[model samples]
Target: MPSDNVYPSSNGPSQVDDTIPIAQGQRTLFEFGSFDHSKIPLEPEEWPVIIIGSSMVGMTLGVLLGYHGIKSVSFDRHPSTAIHPRAALFLLRSVEIFRQLGLEDELRSESASNFDLDAGMIIVEKLVGGKVLASMQESDPAEVAKASPSRRLWLTQNMFEPLLRKRAKEFGAAQEFSETVVHYEELSDGVLVVVQNVQSKSYRKVKTKYLVSCDGNRSATRRKEGIEWQGPGVLGESISINFKADLTPYLGTRAKHGVTYISNPAIDAGFRLESGGKAGFMIVTRAGDKKSFSPDSVSERDAKRYFKEASGIEDDIDIKVDSISYWSVAAFNAERFMSANGRVFIAGDAAHVMPPTGGMGGNTGIQDVHNLAWKLAYVLREKASAALLRTYDAERRPVAGLLMRQAYSRLQKRVFRTVPDEPELPDIVCEIGYRYPSAAAAHIQNPNGDQYEDPHAPLVLPGSRLPHVLLSRDGSQISTLDLIKTNFVLLTTGQSSPWIEAAKGMTLEIDSYSINTDTGTVRDSEGTFSHICRISEGEAILVRPDGFIAWRGEWRKDGHRDELQKALERTLYLSGSKQL
Candidate 1:
């Protein structure tokens, strides 16, 4: 439905300058005119990838595609901040991804310190007419530390987005603000997006090979495409208010213990410290019986009343109201993540929205972008078949379904106050348990007969994530994850000439490294992968470009060359003859 105009005639906003100021030493982020298009080997007619919405998902996708040497355009409707007081928890896996993008330090610096909080779930019971509740004690920090290497950070969406936006600009996929997509049409080869700049009052049509809708729950693209979400709608309303008043004074001793959940019938509230106490305090309240609670409806007086009722605080409470907003606990999965017209796709809330019980929503969206980024790059670079894109839906849809189910489960557990006898935490439910069922994983056979049927268990199968393990080779301890550096790694448990030959043949195009476990050394002349791949048996494994294992077997086994060729073909989407 977008207009046929290739470029709009009018300029940007009159109030704001059309041209952005160039940094003192740094060059302008991206070139805008036709000349910029001509610089690439691809013609202007080549479809550009346009990502709608500039949330974390959109920003991540744009940055990844840009890093992969793909031309992409990202646009958002809002001039500045639209959503507020959103997702506060970023999981460990997300941290790993951020580390890879080199934004981990910036995120850590800008965001809050996670170590201070006692994040485990707690149960509470209120005595008649009493303000204090019989609350469970916080988990010991040392004990919680033993569960996982990474802990979820407590940071608001406001703090997180700016970092992502800045990083996206640094990666050369700077997003355009105040640009709303009016309409879009999917052509045979690309998608045409008609966008209007709300600030400038101008319009332009962009042709993109692929179009991704990272727009939130009420996505315009999804609606226009007649994609109906098929799950539970707004289950309950929750109010989040940001205040400066330290509740710690009231609960002098309890404050030392973190994340107190008040369960009194009169007042149900959850409180946590934000940004190591620098970004004020966060108070969450379930809008009991109220179908909806809007920011406009909840006055400052109401907040004060609730705070007093929740925590017997009547003393001189100096509170600065930063912002307050109501959120819906909705659970819905898109009927389809990808359009039948292959050029269109959806990620994040646009594809699925879940209740924020386990903080699965944001992390799932992050994974969605991670999955799509490489696939898009592969297709664009002609390294793989277009069919590889279909695998995205296959792999992610099921994962989304599982996440929603987990969210519901977590919600039930929270509501019922179900305390397990052992109090075992389902850590892997939101952690590194997701597996891709594409051709890459399909090629893997469980040779060791099924003893453990737990699908969510850490993957040790071929073509799966090589589980992290600690190793000390010649006194230097190294992690298994360090060996993988965004390239193919052939991990050999023993000497194998054929494997080396295959790796050498593909070294011209693909980055291939052979690790000889017998000698505790890798093919990298710089000795980067040597310490990481410390296998000392006859069994060997091959990892794909994205860190997942591509093949695993004993060295020089029967049909070893044939199986290796098949694995390479499936992993890289290359023909049999292409495997030299």
Candidate 2:
């Protein structure tokens, strides 16, 4: 555990404007919430994507876009990385996104693997008492293997952000800390963002082709765009206290668990153990009797008392208090995910906010950027149509909507004690099974017989994620996903010679309800590509750049080439456009 009495030494804010000329009145920079961005870089690069909020969502988007060859500038008002452990749970889908970015091993190394496979859940009478309530040990290892190649984790945002920040910078992202975005205007072809240096009272404007809002709960970007948020109002408030204490004696043999839900009905609290079992923990407690418990209002004596009670350790324990924060367990999402022009978009807490119990907020935001970045890169490279941009809102909004619902359900049972275990199933579903209803689904033929249904099963659908399966080529083993590493591919059967010829000069495919075959080299040795998929032997699936099946086609006895070309042209928006 990091020193309880000592916080990390200042590492300074990231370079905001590298070689940006100070225009007269805009040169003022005042101390803001965190660090001051007085340091400037040597070269001023024109960013293609302007991302507000340098938290998990924004940083993830910045890195994803940057890695895909899009330059972006990300800014946050916080002086440094998150000092507190806010968002901790990492879903498998989020891991998949990082895996594609070549960050799988690095993340897994620091992940919380205590208890079971880092996927276990525990309920207890109290932290100090360590009395078991109803606990679900880790899932079967076989079931875990089926879940994903990238596993779920219990790492905190404070730890996660630094990795994302470094990767984003390495991938050509310009990041600024302690600089807050004040205003932004969506132009006809792009967006103009105005940000202020809180400390210096200085400001600057950044122009980019697109703007992504990852600004978190009180998103000014969402509010400024006149986007309406529709959902249930606030359920209640809780005090999230970040403190340090030796819980070895308290946890005893139970220290393996990452989260312990305190069933001490009186306080209605939950204790989250940070990566190391030593000290750091954030105790979420119901705002006592009064309306809300503001950290400022609580004296050290009272804070210590509440912390002890929440820990179920009323016995005197030397607890070093760090930072205290408060949060509302409300579930809501923007009625609209993007501006009228699609030049601006919202993700993360800006798009939807829910109780942190399910840890869907950060993961959903990561997926949001994953879905949008590739499209933005394709459009910028002229490989896709501008109309394709609309799919961001079309696809991600519903997933966020579902996640928000799941979060609330978890809060109902975990916090309010009103709902049942329904929250459990949705948590799994939202993490990996939520489907998209965008252009990808619209153009693809649902081989499952019904394209409109969202069974939430592990099968691959047009708009859903492609199924994971191991494959072999030239005696080297690889996952089926490796085929679509950075480009769209056409996966078909060896018998479908016509389909092969159809893809002679075009690409549209990958699928679960897929019609794939074990050809000479492309073999689904695990029966994944053959027996498990819904496709026939003489069909082909068109996968997009994001590994989504854009469309599937059956061999036309007359000829499949002409139809294949048209669908490829339509999906890529390359009908009359020149390829870059």
Model 2 misplacement above 4 A: 1-45, 112-119, 287-291, 420-426, 444-459, 473-476, 507-522, 573-580
Q: Which runs of model 1 end up more than 4 angstroms from their true locations? A: 1-47, 81-83, 112-119, 125-150, 256-258, 275-291, 416-425, 443-457, 471-478, 495-497, 507-538, 558-562, 572-580
- Against the reference, the lDDT scores of all candidates come to 0.60, 0.67
TM-score of 2: 0.85
Q: List the residue pairs that clash in candidate 1.
A: 47-209, 48-208, 463-549
Cα lDDT of model 2 by residue, 247-268, tens digit: 7776675666657777664565
TM-score of each: 0.79, 0.85
Q: How many clashes show up in model 2?
A: 23
Top TM-score hit: 2
Tens digit of per-residue lDDT, candidate 1, span 155-251:
6676788768776766768688878777677788887667678767767766778999998776656666667777655565566666766454344
Question: Which one is best on lDDT?
Answer: 2
